[model samples]
Target: MLTHPMPDPIAFQIGPLAVHWYGLMYMLAFILFLVVGRIRLKQAHIAAAGWRYADLEDMLFYGVLGVVLGGRLGEVLFYHPMYYAHNPLEIFAVWKGGMSFHGGFLGVLLALFLWSKKAKRNVLDVYDLIAPLVPLGYACGRIGNFINAELWGRVADPSLPWAMIWPNVDQLPRHPSPIYQALVDGVLAFILLWIYARKARPRLAVGAMYVLMYGCARFFTEYFREPDWVVNVLGWDISAGQVLSIPMILFGIGALYFSYKFDKKAAPTNVAKPKQKHAQ
Candidate 1:
């Protein structure tokens, strides 16, 4: 069994200011989003449609707002409502740590919708473009979680080679869930979605795959993860994360169905239709 290297949460300090690794990770995620977004804009169709740097910047701003607010609320409501309900002010103390992916996802959706409305762009297009970029960012966030020694996984068999001991939680060996999530939900998902998005397939296809892949990854990883709390539903043990992911999977499937059923290709706003040749 490997002992967990519980790195200090604080990355560094400058006199009066303390910089945290988690915050740095988030910043890195945002920066990578811009980089990926630029790559996305390089495509001829996307470039002609005006997927501009300014628009990307604006979307990032809105996404930050959504992530912070939605993550905090989700942590409060979904995981520890009773605790937060009593100490309500702690909810604002994000620096202490607490975030939910599902909440952030919803928050991103809302942000995209608002931005889409203003830009007169289809929200699904924005979603598809952004989806491929998200997993790596998610991977960074999971690294942050690991560094903080937070969200430790469920106890594991002593014989497991990679089983880790988080002294903060207990001396017992536990599944290294954060790493599992990072690889499966972040790296694997990124690869799959990135490959799928490389070529245009159908409207909403990339975004739909993103939702489905992430849902499946999170659900599967939850078995090894220590649940924030377990709910007894229909005589089944379900983690909070799994519960939230279920909706995402269903929504993804529905989106794919609509994309195929409608048989529409996503096109830019100003795309010119081919001129019809009159019969000779």
Candidate 2:
């Protein structure tokens, strides 16, 4: 028989501010991004010509807006369109929880595109730079899910050694999907991006790699993840994540091919030499 381990969502409280573990995870994620991003700014390629740390600061601000708004809207539309439409006010209750990764991803993509355009940067360069910084935040979100005991996975067979019953899900022996996601989507993806992005190349490759890797990981994991209350099945009884991932895989393959073909040469260091003009 399975049982629930109900975790305390609230970590602590400071006066009137109720500090939740999920919120604390978010704070830690942000701090990690700041630390990593600053280090990235000092890299040779970033220090050269036009890229600057200020760009990173600007990007963080815009990215937050994109993630929060896009994630919330995605959850409302993709998962519970009917419920939210009927009770629209519930859409803004983000603190109550319900954000989608796909939505947040789209939001981040759009935000990066806009930032690249404004700064006159190779869009992929910005993407490659930020890719490594993303996964930890995602992992943190999964931790939050675990703390809240939401998004439990499918039932396990009786006598399954690792099976657990989440108290939040009526104490059913469901898979710990958050932990799985934390490993593959959060930790593994971070390692891949962190290793690949440092290469000296046109940035499209890494950006595409990030998308492809994330799509593959998420698509595979969705099998274990429970479907949204009002979502699933497209034409042939498949998950929404699988449907969304197909195009990403294609794009990733294309980008990787091109990066290898055109930008294989190692990127040069940023050391500068003063102009020595010919005296006429």
Q: By TM-score, who's the top model here?
A: 1
Q: What lDDT would each prediction earn against the true structure? A: 0.88, 0.79
lDDT (tens digit, per residue) of candidate 2 on 1-280: 5455666778887899887887777777777778888877777766673566688788988888888888888888778799999999999877666778889988989988998898888777888888878899999888888878888888877587778887666656777788889899899999878877665556577778888898888878877877664244464555666666677778888878887677745345475878999999
Candidate 2: deviation at residue 228, Å?
1.9
- The C-alpha stretches of model 2 lying farther than 4 A from their native spots are 1-4, 229-236, 261-280
Worst-scoring 10-residue span by lDDT in model 1: 260-269
TM-score of 1: 0.91
Provide TM-scores for the models: 0.91, 0.84
- For model 1, what is the C-alpha lDDT against the true structure? 0.88
Residue-level lDDT of model 1, residues 1-280, one tens digit each, is 9999988888999999989898888899899889988887887656766778888899999998888888878888888999998999999878667888888888888988998999899998888778898998898888888888888999999999999999899999999999999999999999889878877767788899999999999999999999998888899999999999999899889988888677546445487889999999
> In model 1, how large is the Cα lDDT of residue 138?
90
